[model samples]
Target: MATPRQDSSPKGFRPAFYRMKDVIRITSLSRPTLYRRIAAGRFPAPVKLGGRASGWSAQALQAWIDNPSGYAAEPTADDPAS
Candidate 1:
């Protein structure tokens, strides 16, 4: 029998914030696509966690995934943005 793989997410790290690798996994987006969105200001900005570390908020990513169309649409005062 095969053993189940264990989840390795750090316990201290809130699920609301995820590492770049985790964001990639959640979005299933290629590196180029990710970079393109970032450049276009169409995606959430990553937070610098350390000298060489960055992460995106899981809440933001999940919100995007949950309502992709809404995510694509820029925030407007009429829409209240959230």
Candidate 2:
């Protein structure tokens, strides 16, 4: 993967969206792992931005990184926490 480009915009002018490659770079996750998490509903879903294009929310991704336990495996009602 190519190195992500540094934001060149002024402090207030940066674009709100990031490409899939950017997302992959930021999360340090392989394509399959990222998609698998999405399929399992453990990660944020990408929004369709344009023709054959999609992107995830930067805020949401950051939040997930900040609190990873929310994505950990959980027991069903029949199972006791241990």
lDDT of 2 at 10: 80
Question: Which candidate number has the best TM-score?
Answer: 2
Deviation from native of the Cα of residue 37 in model 2, angstroms: 0.3
Model 1: lDDT of residue 23: 80
Per-residue CA lDDT of candidate 1, range 1-82, in tens? Answer: 9999997987765675788788888788877888788666577667688899888877777667887555663454544444
* TM-score of candidate 1 relative to the true fold: 0.63
Compute the lDDT for candidate 2: 0.72
lDDT of 1 at 9: 85
| Residue-level lDDT tens digits of model 2 in 27-79 | 88888988888766576667789899888767667666787558643333544
Steric clashes per prediction: 1, 0
RMSD of each: 6.5, 8.3
| Native RMSD of candidate 1 (Å) | 6.5
Worst 10 residues of 1 by lDDT: 73-82
Off by over 4 Å in 1: 1-14, 72-82
